[model samples]
Target chain A: MDSVVFEGIGKRYRSLWALRGVDAAFRQGEVVMVIGPNGSGKTTLIKCLLGLVRPSEGTVRVNGQLVGSDPAYRQRIGYMPQISQFPPALTIGQLLEMMRDIRGLDAETVDDTLVGALGLDRQLEKRLSTLSGGTCQKVSAVLAFRSRPSILVMDEPTAGLDPLSARTVLDQAAALRSNGGTVLITSHLLEEVETLADRVAYIEDGRLRFLLPVKEILQRSGATRLAQALPVMLSNSATP
Target chain B: MTKVYKYTLVDLARNRFVLAFAVLMLVLAEGLFRIEGDAMKAMLSLVQVTLALVPLVTLVFTIVYSYDTQEFTQLLAVQPIRRSAILAGRLAAIATAVLMALAFGLGLPLLVHLPGMVSLLLFAANALLVLVFVALGTLLALTQRDKARGVGIGLVTWFLFVLVYDALLMALMFALSDRPIEPWVVPLAALNPIDLARIAVMLRVDLAAMMGYSGAVYQRFFGSAQGILLALGLMVLWAAWPALVAFRVFRRKDL
Candidate 1:
């Protein structure tokens, strides 16, 4: 069974169909990248898979269980939203501690890992309001990666990170996949996706335009860079 | 379920806003009791502020909290926990936090006066109000989705409860002055939670002279076993209606 599956999944919001007939499966130890332009239903797909938004048609299953039926499916998955809002009053340490407490994970080891990797030990006491955008993004990254759940779903995970922070996140994603974890990530940055993804799923206007192995896509497009190859694929798909 | 509740309580306790509000309530209640010189008046005043105003404030706060934590909620949704359990955990955390604040705010004053059965009754009344309003606020938040709109609806509902409902009732009474509808108005008066709270407390103080004609009217009809039961039922309904609506909406919502 696949680690995550979307079979004929569709989501309708009023008159707008945010996603239509999305069919895909993600396997353990695979790093899949979902790429699309803004308003192309990337977030909607993620939300549907997470069971935050119910699909209007078809089913979304994770690890052979329907997401809607089992709430604990989320416990096996770690999600980093595109934009996170932390309570201004809470210190970085306090926020991380709260998340750990909510998930019922031990604090000592997780805290140590977070401090060492993210260099958050010195900034632990600083309130979230006092942190810069990049710093806040670092905190979010630490929280998402700390639990090391079997399945990781991150939306625009590296949006505001410094180059080093971004590299650390990418390395972590690669490590998780090497450990037989399923990692699904979405981003507008083509380079990150090209480097980290084993499979690429391209979406346009709420429809799946293409899904193929990263190497196949790169070879077929005959473009040296994913940034160049993406446009060719989109233009070709746009005609039909 | 127990684990969820425990974790929820911990989360609520750690929230800085809840902590600050709880402390502020206690301080205010203490100050009111010291200045009032009358125990009943102090209690009455505290109930008005705590049950009426605090719940409204807390309800709006909860709505905003839920909206602001959309990402967090999304993260939790992918977990092994049931969606209902997640919502229940959140609701339980919010309800317990609000109740604790109410208790500390009003409980301190009651302790000073050494309230009897009357205190328990007041507490029950206040609890009903809090539950009803929180549920209403949740439903409003779910329905509106927008933070500003939800807060606006909450404020309007508060105004209706605190001001408009009574104003409308008074207008109706004046319009019906010629019909001698005093007997029929007794049941209608029981419909309002604010009125019920006022009557419950006033009855404890002195139903005979303090309530005047309204007191006699209450005693004549609702003063009976069945009438009192009916009044209590209305209060329960007030608490139940919004909660039931919220639960149903939440169950189906694509949050």
Candidate 2:
């Protein structure tokens, strides 16, 4: 079953159309990496799915329910925004406690694996403002995954992480995909997507250029690596 | 809503700026009381200071806090909560923090020195003023996307409320002093929370002679219990209108 669907989504900010007629669907268990250059509306597409940006047209469906109709559906979605914006005054521990309190999730149901994996447990007492950009990103990751969400939406999840931390995130995404959880991510790292994404969503100039499986992309372009295959595939697809 | 409010309050409690504001108020109030050596005189001095200072502080602080929490607001927006809860919670937390600062800084001084009905009314008036400005600040923050512009607008709003509005009203009154405009001008006070608060406390303080023409009219018109209630009701309306509009804007706004 399709766990998430965006039907002809369109978003306009003042004069610029950030997204126009974007349509796609993610299966119950798949990792789809959204690929686009800067200012290509990749984040806007993800925001529309998260209901952070209301689509000027069309609708988003999560678990077969309309996105804006109810917020309860978000309980199943774990989102890590590209920029970490937790309260600056809060310690990492306090922020975690606050999220748990907001969700009303008890101790037994809460997942703290990322807390240990991200090394956030040791730095729990550090205020968000005091943490470096990389550490803050890890905190965002821990919060995103801690809820044990069925549908995960991570926007450039590994943008600021070190290689080791980035690997842990990828492993977590892979583990979640294997457990039948859907993961939607956007990253500039095509190599990471090579091993992680089941499918690739290439968005450019505020439009979805293509949505194809990874194996098909490699096969169609006749390139072994995604880095070389994507350009060839886009040019080939653009021509025909 | 309570969850948002609780966490926001927790975040605010950790803020040193708010603590400094409280301390500043305490020092000012205590200083005035010590110099005057009389509770009533000290309160009169404090009233003038707060009339200008409280709104300015609340507006600036609220605007900065709202802008700083943009990321936090975005984070909460994707959660399983209504937009209204997020807005109301943050607004309530700002109000609570400012009110606590006022209560400790000013209210405690009043309770220690005056300890009477007039002082209590003064505290209530200050509290209402805080709410009104916080509402205005929230509206300003939500409307203006740029932080510098928002803070600039906030300062202008404080100026208009604390100084410009009264100046315009007084100028109009003096220009129209020949006509029977005093009665009509009484309602105009309701348009400004600062004016309403000033009139409300002045009446209780029994300062009709000091009250200008409009204030005298307010005293005469709303001198009774029903009149005081009516003024407070108007202040509450002032406190709520901007916040309600801000909430509506937030509902459809792209975070």
Candidate 3:
């Protein structure tokens, strides 16, 4: 069974259709890079999959289970939103402690790898509001990886980070994929997409424009690099 | 739910705005006691102060906090927690923090100086009032996304309940003074949660006259034990109904 499935999902807000009759499946243990133009429903599709946005029609099945109304269903998924801001009063340590309690994880089970790589231990006692944008993004990335979830859904995970931090994040994400975690990621960074994706899912104007393997996309576009190939793919899809 | 409730409570307790309100309550309570000298007189003045201010602070603070906490709430929404639990935890924590500020800021001071059932009733009424308004504000937040508009709605809601609702009710009663509107009194009072709380506290504090002609009519019905229960029940329903509405909106809301 597919790890995630969106079956005829449609979302509309006051006549503005965010996603319309969108159907797609994320194969088990495959890295699917969700690429799309701004406001083309990429984020909407992702939110729908996570049950943050209820669909106007149809359903989402994750590992053959219905997505919303069940806390247990979310335990196997790790989500890193494109933008996240937590309460300023909480220290990083406090937030982590809260997360641990919420997830019912043992205290000893904290994922030290992401924490160490991000150097969050040094900043654990600092208040969340005191951190800079990139630092906050680092905290969000680290927290998403804390539970060793079977699925990771990330939105622009590397957008705010410095080059070195971005590289480290990509390295960790690739390692997670290698360990059989199914990832549904969205990014505008073509290099990150090429390095991290096993397949590409492109959406435009609330429609799935293309869902293709990296090689096929590259071959069809007649370009070796994702940055160059993306334009060709988008142009080819735009014609009809 | 317990974990979320704890963390949220801890977070709100340390909120600088809440802390400032806490200090204001403590100072006011202490000053009012000194000014009145007599505990009963002081308690009466404090009751009026709390009744006006609690709803205002609770409503405005709640709407602002609710607006500000959307991002974090979104984070919690995606967590492995039930939708209802997420809401329940946050509201419970807000209510708890509001209650703590009330108790520690004013209740503690009054307990030390006056140390009577009147002070206790004031505390109880104020606590219930905060919960009711917070639930109301949370519902407003859930229904409306625009921060300015939500805050505007919340302010108007506070103004209506604390001041205008009673004035309008009294005006209606005055317009029909010759007729026997006695039958309409308790039910009308029951319409506003703040009024329900006021009646509950007033009856206990021996200020039935302040309630006026309708107060005299209300005294006949709410004076009874059954009426007291009804009043308390109405207040609980007031707090609960909005919470239920917000939860329904929340579960179906596309954040």
Candidate 4:
């Protein structure tokens, strides 16, 4: 199966360690929710995978190719950052055109299915800064999924999104996962995680604390649901 | 890479500040022409603006613009584009934008007035000014994160080049007045892009009239076609040096 392998990944910024000797894999055709508290190296891990931030130690491989050595590897993975900030003056149309141009794809060849679903056609003329947070998140969604990448790494995908738009975004991501694509999502919203994540990787203090299926997490915690089980698991892990 | 350049150029070319700059240049150049009634005199005034305002505007504008495009850079960074391409493309975009503004701004008025060589040399000098400053701005922006401090350094850089450096040269000239400082003055001045461009123009137009003894010294070394070629070559080197530095920083930078 296709997988992104993190082999003893370590990242250090001066004296502070962001990720330490961590080994993990985001395997294909599954929605893997990476859950962690704030500043738990979640963003750092994502950046390392994208090759935006170089790792202090170890290597990251996407489909067995080093992410750093291969720019083409990035084409297979679509990434959506936590914040959906773009150039303030740029219109959505212009941005999409630039993206399409950069991707070396023609209009007819490009798949902007998410754009149509989100009703972004009317808002295409609007400047980026004018959009509400939810709408901006939607634009980010389109950019991520429109390219039809095999893997999607979304950092806090629906943080500022409205319930309805968030549903659309989640549904689009889920659709991508069901179509033999791998998805890696990080979010504080456990309810969404429960609905979407097939397996959850609990990260804390720059290490993968626990990784288990949602059902197993619930069963082991002696709780009926993942929401209730998460606290129990956290307490047990802390004691251990 | 070409795609990045195309969009960056187009996007920046249509920016309001670029348009405003162009309009302001037209107004200033035309007004100077009307007031002085001599194209040569008007060009001298324009040269001062080019030396002072061009560097500051290009440096500050490029730095601020670089910070503004951070998000866009992120968007591109995740793509199949190389980091060097991303940095170089953006730098080229900004240089192209600023050059276009200066061209249209000054070109609208002075194109019809100045002699062909003088007009072309003037434009070349200004273009080099834009390239050099933008490259420096790129390096500064890559190294420094704080916008206020970055902008502050940019302002100080302008002040150093436009005012302080010249003042220091004047002091050096005074101290070594009897020591054949003539040789040192021109060589030292060549280090600054502004000084190099200023000499390039002064040699072409009126060197002896405006510059007194120092002018004669410069005219002797930089008076010939070979000297002019060398000066222009140095100006190109000035642009290339900072651009190379920025590219190196950009490649190693963590987004």
Candidate 5:
């Protein structure tokens, strides 16, 4: 079953089209990478899927239910926002504990797994505001991944991570897909997407321009590097 | 509903600054009561100020907190919990926190001066005011979506209630000096929550004389059982309107 479905979804801010008639879907266990230049509605598309922005036209659904009709739809998904701010005084441990409590999950086991996965046991007591950007991203990643949500919607998830942390997160994403979880990730790191994504969906000017298998993209662009392939893909599909 | 309420209470309790502020307000209230020999008079004045100002301040706090916690709210929205539950949780948390603060600020003063019915009335009035303001604040915060603008609007509304509303009433009275104070005018005072609270408490203390002509008018009309009932109804409306408006906005909002 498709974990996400969008049919003719569009969002407008005043006179500007943030997104226009975007049709897409992601099935369970698939890793879909969304790539676009700035103002190409990459973030807008994600927001609409997450029910953060109501599409002015068409429908958005998660697991076949309308986005607005059911709040429970959110529980099945984990979202990592591009820019997230934590309460200034909360420690990493406190943050995790609070989310767990709010979600009504047992803290002991989840805390143990989170600490092991992120190697954050040492920084558990450190205040969120004091943490570096990379550390904060790690905390966010843990929060998104902790519950083992069925669907993960991450925006720029690996932006600030150190190389090792980035690799760990990517590995986790792969593992999640293997376990039948759906992952929809957006990032400027084309090389990372090339390494992890099973399918790539390129959007331009608020409209979806390309949806192709990763291998197909690599073959068509005739480039061994994703960095080399990205320009080729964009230039070929520059027209709306 | 209980989970939302419980979470709100817990979050409010964890905020050190708010807790400290509540403590400070309680101390001030206690000191003021001790300094003033007439307990009823002191309590009445203090309740007036608290009802008008605390709600406004609480509203500002709610807006700032909401803006600061935007990411948290986004995460919460994705949770399986209902959107209404999320909003209710935040509102309940803020209202409970502010109510605690108001209790500390006004509770001691009432206890020191008029410890029984007067204290209870003051507490009830304070609670109503807190709910009304929190609801108002949430609506304003959701509507404005900007911390500075929301806070500014909250402060202006506070000023109007705490100072300008009464001043305008007095000016109106002065302007109508030539006409007799009508029975209907007494009910108009109920339009302002602060005014109705003042009337209710002052009537209890037998200090209606302090209000001059307005006092006389109130005694002649709403001074009886029906008048009190009407005043209470108006107060309920004051608290209800903002809450309903806020709930409507939150239900439709993207985040």
Candidate 6:
């Protein structure tokens, strides 16, 4: 069964439709990279799945449960937002502890893989306001992975990180995939998409243009690289 | 909800804004008490100051804080936390922090100088004003997505409640001076939360005569237990209605 499904999802903001009839599904043990231009509903689609934005029409199902009022389904999901802004007054340790408490996880049982890997344990005393953009991103990455979620949604997860940190993040996502966790990522980095994505979900103009495998995209476009194949695939079938 | 509230309260406490407000209140109230040299007189003076400052500070702070925590709100929204919890937690924390400041700044002086029913009433009035304005601020913040616009609206809202509403009422009273406007004026005064708070405390201190016609009208109309109950009910409603509406708005709101 699909771990997540967006069935004919539609979201309209006043006169503008931010997302219209967006239908897609992510199977377990696969990383689906959501790709799109700016304001093309990539974030909107992810927000809809996370119940951050309510759809104007249609339903979303996760683990066969309908997404609406109950937030229980969110427990199994981890999200790393593109913008990393936490309570500036809080130390990194306090923020992490708060998240752990909210999730009702014992401190002893909490996962510290990301914290250790990102070197956040040492800087846990630092206030969020004092951290640089890259450090904040690392903290966000830690929060997303600390919960050991079955489904991961990362929006521009590597936009601000140094190359090494970004590589670590991609590796973590890969590890999650190896463990049969489903990952949904949106990125402008086609290179990262090619390396990490099992299926590429393309969205444009508030609609899902295509959701194809990397190999299928390369084969259909007769191109050796995903960067070359994306344009060909998009142009060939503009209405998917 | 408790976890969110706990974290938010801790965050607010750690931030200097709440503490600064607390210290300012303490100094002001302490200075007033020292200068006046009379507990009743100091409490009376504080009534006016609290009535103005509580709403203005609460309005501006809540709106600004809401915008500041938008990203954190997103993080919470993706967690297992309900939107209502998120909304309630933030509002509660704002109220708690502001109320704490009011208590330390104003409550301490009131407790030390004037330990009476009137001082207690003034404290309650300040607490209620915090609730009303915080709710209004939450509404303004949620309705206006842009931070500058939200804060702008908050200022206008404060102006309308604090100064404009009274000015309008005074104008209405003057225009209708020839007629007995008590019947209409009573409900009109009740419409503004600030007016309601002022009247409640003003009447408790037996300073209605000093409040001019509006106070006399309220004393005559709301002097009875039933009328006071009705006023109290209205004040409670003032605190709750906006918060309830904001909660609904937040639930339906797309983050």
How far off is residue A154 in model 4, in Å?
0.9
Deviation from native of the Cα of residue A204 in model 3, angstroms: 1.1
lDDT of 1 by residue, B7-58 (tens): 5565566677777777887787788888988877777677667656665667
Per-residue accuracy of model 2 over A75-127 as CA lDDT, tens digit each: 98898988998777889998898888888799789889989998887898988
Clash totals, every prediction: 11, 0, 0, 0, 0, 0
lDDT tens digits, residues A1-240, model 5?
A: 888999999998889988888888889998999988899999889888887778899998888989875766777788887776776666787777777777778855452454566779888888787888888888888988888888998899889988888888888888889999999999998877678898888898898988777888778889787678878977786332
Candidate 5 lDDT, tens digit per residue, B1-255? 566566546656767757776876777677667777777666766766666656666767777777777777777776677777888888888888877777666775566567797678667777777777778888888888778998899888878777798898888888987887574466568767778877776766667788888888877666776776676667889988888888888777866
Instruction: Give i-RMS (Å) per prediction.
Output: 3.4, 1.1, 1.0, 1.7, 2.5, 0.8
The positional error of residue A238 in candidate 4, measured at the CA in angstroms, is: 6.6
* Cα lDDT tens digits for candidate 2, B167-229: 899899999998999767877888888888888888888886796777668778888878888
Across A10-93, the per-residue lDDT of candidate 1 in tens digits comes to 899999998999999999999999988899988899888887788899998889988676566676777777777675666787
- Top-lDDT structure, candidate number: 6
Provide the DockQ value for model 2. Answer: 0.77
Predicted complex 3: DockQ: 0.79
Q: Which residue pairs in candidate 2 have backbone atoms (N, alpha carbon, C) closer than 3 angstroms, thus clashing?
A: none
Best-to-worst ranking by DockQ: 6, 3, 2, 4, 5, 1
Score residue B180 of candidate 6 by CA lDDT.
Answer: 87
Q: Can you give the lDDT of residue A180 in candidate 1?
A: 93
| Model 2 lDDT at residue B148 | 100
Model 1: residues with Cα > 4 Å off, grouped in runs:
A86-115, A121-132, A238-240, B1-36, B41-51, B177-187, B207-214, B221-233
- Those runs of model 5 whose alpha carbons end farther than 4 Å from true positions after fitting are A87-94, A101-112, A122-132, A238-240, B179-184
Tens digit of per-residue lDDT, candidate 3, span B184-244: 8888888898888778778877678987897788788887768767887888888999999
Which 10 consecutive residues of model 4 chain B have the lowest summed lDDT?
Answer: B205-214
Q: Candidate 4 has what TM-score?
A: 0.95
Q: After superposition, how far is residue B211 of candidate 6 from its true place, in Å?
A: 2.7
Q: After superposition, how far is residue A79 of candidate 6 from its true place, in Å?
A: 0.4
